[model samples]
Target chain A: MKLLEEGIPLAELSIERIARTAGVGKAAIYRRWSGKEELFVDVVRSAEPADPELPGTSMRADLVVLLETQRQRGVFSRQSVILHNVHAQMKSSPKIWAAYQNTVIAPRRRLGLEVLRRGQSNGELRDDVDIELLYDLFVGPMLVRSVLRPDGDLPDGLAERIVDTLLEGLRPVSSRPG
Target chain B: MKLLEEGIPLAELSIERIARTAGVGKAAIYRRWSGKEELFVDVVRSAEPADPELPGTSMRADLVVLLETQRQRGVFSRQSVILHNVHAQMKSSPKIWAAYQNTVIAPRRRLGLEVLRRGQSNGELRDDVDIELLYDLFVGPMLVRSVLRPDGDLPDGLAERIVDTLLEGLRPVSSRPG
Candidate 1:
């Protein structure tokens, strides 16, 4: 990651070079990670912020915390060159991306599903729609700003704003309550 | 695109090669596009489906059209090897990504904003939030399914489902009206 942060393209990062840089033998690297792709996957997972502890206060709060984690990651990722290189490399190399997806994305998705299930049982979320679809509604916008759009900003309060807006819906109030 | 679809990597694509493949002179390619990046951008734009003409029936209807276009594109892109290569290359090359964003993403964004604004004026949407925020809420979910999540599916009626659910709100109703 330090090498990636310094703009070392993932392609140029050989295990031997990595071991040398770390003052270790190549055997040390091969012992833990079979190859560069596997090593890259581990690096991304390690760098990612741990999943948030749900507040268990309410569905909205839990969702906010989940999104806030993404928000912070987005902010940091933008400031670093590693993500850009890693992301491009991951896409270019399907094996690394698959490993990353199975390890990182799948677990995060399960966490989201758990929260939505809790929301459903507690009467915090509308249960008429498919739960997976509901989860996408909650998580997608923040990700758009956080991951997809390079220019998207993760301003303070964005997580709360997203949750509140989705809960409240975009429908104009029949009459302004205030 | 032919080369890309056949699994030729972008790094190996050169104007001379492209011209040779197309049976055109290098000067002919240069006269049309400033460089390989510009030509690649043109190819992407040309390949992208034409933007949908809004139905002008209601905000819900219009939004469905917009999202449906994305859904179709998503489905097509997943099937095309060209996209996998182009997408990776685009992200790797800042210059190409910038040009693609400016020409493709910018106009798409403007269309989204326009639709959202119209919805607000017609009392179909809440005016309290910033319009851009509102736009993000509507577009973000579909994009997540369409762009960010590689395994996400774009089934029929997904556009309507997203639009309707968003308009209806996710808050549990005080009582089930149905």
Candidate 2:
């Protein structure tokens, strides 16, 4: 993991090189993992922040925690050079990118879907909106700030603000006559 | 454009190579553009779909058009391998990426902002919410599907759906004991 953080391209990394750098025998690594690919998958998993233990108070509360996890990750991704490089390098290796997607992104997406599903069921969310679009609508802004527009600020209260804002929306309510 | 669409890594491409490929002299190319980076920037700009001549209509109508433009782009990006490769290649070349951002991305961002600012002023949007967040909220889901989650569907009517959904919001209207 340290070796990768140094921006060593994954293609150039070998188990023997890793062992030599760490002053350990190659056999030690082989005994723990099948190969570098397996090891790398593990390393990235360890590096990623774990999913939040939801509050279970309400779907709203649960979503706040979920998006907060994304906010924390956004902070981490911006700060962690190791993580930034791993994602960049992973894209270059199609096999590794696919593996990472299956292992990391897919599961996370499923977890998000499940939350929206529950919210719809509980009448917290409107059932008319497609649950998948709802998930993207809720999650997309943080991601836009995190990934697409680097200049966009991620200030504190972002998670709550995003959830609350989406829950209510940007349109001004009409002032109905009493 | 043809040269780039061929998937030749930009680093491996040169003015001379481009000229030769196009069956033109290097001097002819140089006569028009100063250098490769400048030429590359223009090629990408031309390749991108032109922005909509927004209907001088209500904010909701205009916003729907703006998002609909994004939806069109989302469609183009998915279909055009050239676009996908250009975006990927641009990321690898910091200088070109900066140039692209300046020429291509920055103006589009301003346009989106201007529309939102107008909406806020004209009572289409809530004055209390940050305009930037509002911009991202409207634009983010389309972009998320466009750039982040490729498997996330970008079906027809997505622009209208996102706009209408956001305008009203996801939270179900309270039953007023009618």
CAPRI grade, predicted model 1: medium
- Model 1, residue B117: displacement in angstroms? 0.5
Model 2 / residue A75 / CA error / Å: 1.6
Please give, as one word, the docking class of candidate 2. Answer: medium
Candidate 2 C-alpha lDDT tens digits along B60-105: 8888888888877778877888988888888878888888888777
lDDT of 2 by residue, A71-157 (tens): 878787778888888877778777777777887788888988888888888888888898889999999998999877666698888
Which pairs of residues collide in model 2?
Answer: none
All models: lDDT? Answer: 0.86, 0.83
Report how far off residue A140 is in candidate 1 (Å).
0.7
In candidate 1, what are the lDDT values of residues A31-122, reduced to their tens digit?
99888888989898777677788888988889999999999988887876776567767877778888888878899999999999998899
- Model 1 stretches astray by more than 4 angstroms: A5-8, A12-20, A23-36, A175-178, B3-8, B11-35, B175-178
User: Where is model 1 chain B poorest over a 10-residue stretch in terms of lDDT?
Assistant: B169-178
Number of the top lDDT candidate? 1
